[model samples]
Target: MEADPRWIETPDDGELADRLRQGGEAVRAELKKVIIGQDDVVEQVLTSLFAGGNSLIVGVPGLAKTLLIQTLSEVLDLSFNRIQFTPDLMPSDITGTDIIQEDPDTGQRKLVFMKGPLFANIVLADEINRTPPKTQSALLEAMEEKQVTIQGRTYGLSAPFFVLATQNPIELEGTYPLPEAQLDRFMFQINIDYLPEDEELEVIQRTTTVAGEPPQAILSAEAIAGFQHLVRKVPISESVARYAVQLARRTRPGRDDAPDYVRQYVGYGASVRAAQYLVLGGKARALLRGEVNVSFDDVRSLCAPVFRHRILTNFHAESERVTTDDLVKQLLDDVKPPKSGM
Candidate 1:
């Protein structure tokens, strides 16, 4: 492992960047002990975490999406709660509800708030699409505001709150597609594919044999929060910032600079949130690589995940077998980054 460059032995230097690289490597190593492959998925999920954003993991069953989130929660040393979303799951069940309570002496009844599963540092919303829109909307506030409002009272969630949700891509029989508004709230729509043949064999061998020890905690919630703050402090040049904005803007079908493919396939362009995540994710990615500044490469690397869910594909694109991912690639190729800083 390459030693981090930012950790100078000095009292005044906080060494936040060095800590981020070390913590990131340690977490990845710990995750590798359990997870066989899907390194890209792991990196993207961690990028979202360090960027202080939520993720929507889409994959088929048996892809270990749930296990990935659980392992991440353990390594990060954060409180983990998994809410298995179902058709019958109600909003109150997710947010929490007040119940009638009786006093023994006074024989008086009063409503007491019962905390639900959303009050953890890391929340795994398993099968998110299995639940109805009403229940899914319950997570909106918790994800965006980092707090839940109940009965006109707001209960702040624990610091370093992250919602890593999983959804089955092949099964839509009884699933409700996430609304655009709710999907936009997620920072990345990560797609987990099948493992390579050798990696799959390794996974099977490990599973058939006796289970090994679980990954130990690597970082605390406080540390994660601090790193998230540090990520925001990482600087990006004006040229890189402009490239990120241009990439996001070109995704809109009606934009003057929109590509021909985008105009034909996309119904609407990516929102401002997409650009925000691109920059934030770039900052996190730069920090993870032990780089001092965000680069255009960092922004380009995250374009697919950041815009995959935000870009809406029209019927023409679907008929032509053109996915949003394809359109994003074309847009990136079409939009050239500025030669120098603006």
Candidate 2:
């Protein structure tokens, strides 16, 4: 990857850039200990982390979606908590509730706020769709605001907090599809698939044998925060930033510039947050690959993951068996970048 000519000169910029690249590679190397494939999945998830955004992982069973996320927390050496969302789960369960407590000396009855699983640095909401919207929304505030309100009191979550949620797409028996508003909160809806034949065989062989050593932690919570702060310093040309905006804008159904397919199949287009994430994700991705500047290719490569969940599809698309991914793909093809920088 070529560093952008517009890159701002900073002291030890190259050294820090190398550290970021090596740190990313280190995480991937550690994941290889148990996880066999899905390099893209790992990359996207890590990008979201660097961008300070949450992700929704979709996959069928036995794909190691949960395992991958759990391994990530270990590799980062961050505090980890896993919540198995179920149909009967309560909102208070995910965000702890206030309970009555009596003091031994004064005999005074008071309510003590108990913290729940959502307070950790890295939270894995496994099978997020399994819970009702009420419970699912309990996490929405924390994901967005980085704090949970209980009994009218707001509690701050530790910095560098990330919610990596997983959903089993095949089973819809008791699943409550996330609301469109909540869906937009996630930076990317990552789809993980079964491994290749050789990778599958390797997984079986590895699992059948004696358990191996766990992945060693590479970056600490402080180091991750440092990278996150550094990501914001990466710059993109105005043309490229406009290209990212146009890419999100074209997803709208009514706009004259929207493609015929989008007008026909899409009910609503992505919000401005889509563009913001596109740019932010691009910066993080650039740094992850050891590049010092954002490129057009960086924004284009993230279109699917960023737009798929933001664009709301209509009945026409569903009836024709068209997916949101199809809409995003068409958006990328039909929307031409600016002749110069875009």
**Per-structure clash totals for the candidates:** 1, 0
Give candidate 1 misplaced runs (Cα > 4 Å): 1-14, 104-107
| Tens digits of per-residue lDDT for model 1, 165-208 | 99998998999999999999999999999999999999999999
For residues 227-270, what per-residue lDDT tens digits would candidate 2 score against the true structure? 88889989899999999999988889889988889889999999
lDDT of 2: 0.89
TM-score of each: 0.94, 0.94
Model 2 bad stretches (over 4 Å): 1-14, 104-109
Whole-model lDDT per candidate: 0.88, 0.89
